[model samples]
Target: MELGSDLNAGEITIAQYLKDVGYQTGMSGKWHIGKEPKAAGFDFSVFFKSNGTYYGRQINDEGIVRKVEEHCDLYCAERSVDFIKEAVKKEAPFFLFHNTQLPHMNGDLIWDARKETKERYEVSEMPVAANRLDDLSGKPEYLKSVRNLSQAKVYGYPDEQAIQKHTRDYYAVITEMDEYLGLLFQTIEDLGLKENTYVFFMSDNGWMLGEHGFTSKVLPYRPSTRVPLFVIGPNLKPLDLDQMVVNIDIAPTILEMAGVLLPDNLHGKSLLPLLKQETVNWRSSFVYEGLGTYGGALPNLTVINKDFRYIETFENGTLEKVIFQEFYDQNNDALEVNNLMGSAAVKSKVGEAQKLINAHKNRILKQ
Candidate 1:
């Protein structure tokens, strides 16, 4: 039922999948995927919207909009924690999907938290990204004029000061989120649900704090593409994994965890093997995609591997036609400051990247 070439456009979600197998599903915070949580089979939902304000937040609860007083993220967390505690009392297993707005800087971009938490970190203390000073020479021209809510204050200032302030606030907001997560985790611990519950933490996307002089996501850059993923549950060893992963795998992983039969058309592989410390042959790389922004920016796709990232940026004017290609040697240039596209030195690796992209396109367009 996934119509597009993008496999991330899922028809059956993890919630729907789990619901079929008998699990109590609940969700809070942003549901950006167009459909409401009920449509996707969640029994209980809250505060779900595409994006908006923090305080005086308008949250949709079973089709009713309730104006909330506290910050949106904290309010959602408190409700989610309460749901977790109450849900376990029932006979069914529960899956509480807790999403927070603390880290999200979209739309008028509320950079807010508790007063003490926001001021806890000094601006100088937060370490800026290595590519924070990127001049945008290799980037598209239209991106320069994107003065929307996410980037107005971020790109309006002088370079270093902008990066410092953005990074400082980012950390500040994350610190507040950490406090909320601590509360949620403690609830799980106290309720004796740690052994049975699997808490998977990840974001839809990562932001660029002046990386390549950009303030928002939607670029093929690592700063925008790479996100922190944490999977915690009983009998799972805690260790760093260098394997390539993506958000697509989340649904399939959940189904696998719940002992459901995997549909053959799934575009993602489960991480259960990896979590059990078993040796499994996993994907060497994957594609990063960004659809054009309301005729403003161009649609771009990148073939990303451990050692290299190759991009094919399409024309904004024509949309379908390729305008330019970029290749980064991620080994030597981890910050992605250098573009080796069409360079004679990396032609062989570039060829491999092209093949990868072609194969991925074929896989995506199977419908």
Candidate 2:
């Protein structure tokens, strides 16, 4: 799991599993694991390295590396549409892993949003986060170091004007990405595949647009940890479910949908039952672990449930020394502005959160 390292040979990726089950697999956009998508079981791919440039980035089309003139998100979408058309021509089931880099910061700010899209939003109209100027007094001390090292520092601590501009550009890039997604969705409907194809809309992580005076995703705050996850497919109810889920669930869900057996080693449960509106027991709590990828933030394990979130910060990557702890009542403080770890109200629940964290660690150790 080192940076730029190849995916382990034994890892059974979703693409590999789908291809094994006779489905055509294609990938477009970021493939930073190492080597290329082909080694990871993608039959066809147009990919680039980590956080590719929005314009004129080098792309590897099936093995031919070349610079593309158009925006990377748009290019990736078009290539994915091409893959879908090819698969339809062959009358084959296909899985296209299309990744987009839109809305992600390019350097200290968002800079590559299309001109027309960028103009749609006025900076003066953008709303800044309430905690944009937080001094980090109530939170973990490491967050102060993170704020100093993060993009907010590069942007000169982000005054009101700077924050508004960043937010405006963020919205613009997202709108651009939405238009690109429309192209894919329209293609699917036009090809008569709308009834069968499953389109999952999700993000790898959420960004901090001046949230708690931070500008990146390394912190374990709600703004950084929470992300959108929705599935579109045939016969699935449109209603929302309140149960919590994690990214690991994606693999098993897709496997079940394809009628492929779920591997016993997979830790996440399939969400197909929930999607079908079936009554079933679901997870009440989920754990979030951050390994301090940015070096300024401390490693931490957080237990998040409907009632509260408990975070235990460690001293280093070893995760041995518990240096700090935080507890927040989710129902009362949805924004997680208040830390209640030292309060008597959460003393009893602290043990419960620790037990959950221990259970997760034991499960990982067994795996």
Candidate 3:
């Protein structure tokens, strides 16, 4: 589906399910999925369309469009806190989708981070990505062409200075976002809701910060696909997990936590067992697909595990006509600088990966 387009009416959202089960739902910031948050089951909404400007912009306050002069993140945080406060006063279980637009580029190579936050970092001290300088000659032809022609090449192929500036602004905006989030966290704590509330932090997608000479996502590489997932709540121990998990798992997990029955149509398993640190059978590998959102990126399907990532690029978004393949031994080549597709040792593994991919396709079709 396109950005700003309505989601399929036949599909049910987690918000709709929760609202049916007696939860007050509110959303703030970045509601790009067409119509308004109310249509998606949010009872209270203060949202903006698409990627909003960091400065003055229009916000939809429960169907009223008004100009917000403050940074969008701050406005979102304040509104989220207010939602929580109101929900608490009503003695209702609440779900606040407090989204933000921080760190995402406002325009081509333009970052609108707060001046104080941006000044905290010195450009000279910013560490460049290890693969930023790669020429992409050994990689896919599509990536090479993208590096040469995309808007990322406007200031030339991301020299140390350019990469440093990007990193600095990126880090600064994230820090500013964290500062704003602290207010909501403090409000929750002050209201004695920290023990009862689950705070899940995650990103929709990871960005390519000069990795493989690319600046955007939509590639089937670690830098473009991998993102952080953090879950904080009552009785959850602090520990790291190596098991593979997908974004789909989040919905089932939340439903399980809220004592709702898992829908048969749900494609993901509940992560409650994993969160409790119980030994459980988990996925060893999962399929990752990219539909070429950025310029020159081919539609690709990939199987990624802790040990390796195998990608098959297609001729177009229809995903027909396999044009190129890439295999990376992630154990040793974390940066994916070397392609292992031609190696004799990985020949058998390639067949195994294809089998896994086909199995995933069948499962998706069944769903």
True-structure lDDT of candidate 2: 0.84
For every candidate, C-alpha RMSD to the true structure in Å: 3.1, 1.8, 1.8
- Candidate 1 residues lying further than 4 Å off, grouped into runs, are 1-10, 146-158, 317-319, 363-367
Model 2 lDDT per residue over 1-367, tens place: 5558886668878999999999999999877687678888899999887774688888888789899998888888999999999999999999999988776755434567878888999989998888777776668776766643476767644588888887887888889889988889999999999899999989988878777777868678888888999899889878987889999898899999999999898889999999998898999999997765565777788998899999988887656688888898999887778888778878999999999887876765564
Considering summed lDDT, which 10 consecutive residues are worst modelled in model 2? 103-112
lDDT of 1 at 325: 85
Quote the positional error of residue 208 for candidate 1 in Å: 0.9
- Record all residue pairs in model 2 with backbone atoms less than 3 Å apart, i.e. clashing: none
Candidate 2 deviant stretches above 4 angstroms: 107-109, 147-150, 156-158, 363-367
* Predicted candidate 1 versus true structure: per-residue lDDT over 155-196, tens digit per residue: 554357666766777788888788878888999889888898
Name every residue pair that clashes in candidate 3: none
What's the lDDT for residue 257 in model 3? 95
In candidate 3 the C-alpha lDDT for residue 8 amounts to 69
Give each model a TM-score: 0.91, 0.95, 0.95
Rank the models by TM-score, top first: 3, 2, 1
Model 2 vs. true fold: TM: 0.95
Off by over 4 Å in 3: 147-149, 362-367
